[model samples]
Target: MPYITVKMLEGRTEEQKRNLVEKVTDAVSETTGAPKEKVVVFIEEMSKNHYGIAGKRVSDQ
Candidate 1:
């Protein structure tokens, strides 16, 4: 099984998330030689306040 994790900020629409998973699965299956059914994609979304860059939280930007 090929497990893929994608972490990003929250608030994306369901459609966008679905599309992202589909595309990621396609790429993973093609490159890793794993079956599409075995390619697992996990999406982890975080709040802006929980993610930071350069000593500043995303929410503060």
Candidate 2:
């Protein structure tokens, strides 16, 4: 069982998240030779304030 975790700033449409998971699963499966059914993906979305860049929070940008 291969587990993949994706972390990004919160605020993506449902369709976008769906497509992201599907594409990521396909890529992992293709490269690792893991069955699609056995591939696991976790989406972790955080608020802009929870993420930062250049010592500044994304929410501030």
Give every collision pair in model 1: none
User: For model 2, how does the per-residue alpha-carbon lDDT over 13-38 read when each residue is reduced to its tens digit?
Assistant: 99999999999999999999999999
Number of the top lDDT candidate = 1
Encode model 1's per-residue lDDT on 1-61: one tens digit a residue: 9999999999999999999999999999999899999999999999999999999999999
Q: How far is candidate 1 from the true structure (C-alpha RMSD, Å)?
A: 0.5
Listing every candidate in turn, what is its Cα RMSD in Å to the true structure after a full C-alpha superposition? 0.5, 0.6
Q: What is the lDDT of candidate 1?
A: 0.98
Candidate 1 lDDT score at position 52? 95
* TM-score of each model, in listed order: 0.96, 0.96
Off by over 4 Å in 2: none
lDDT measured at residue 16 in model 1 versus the true structure, 0 to 100: 99
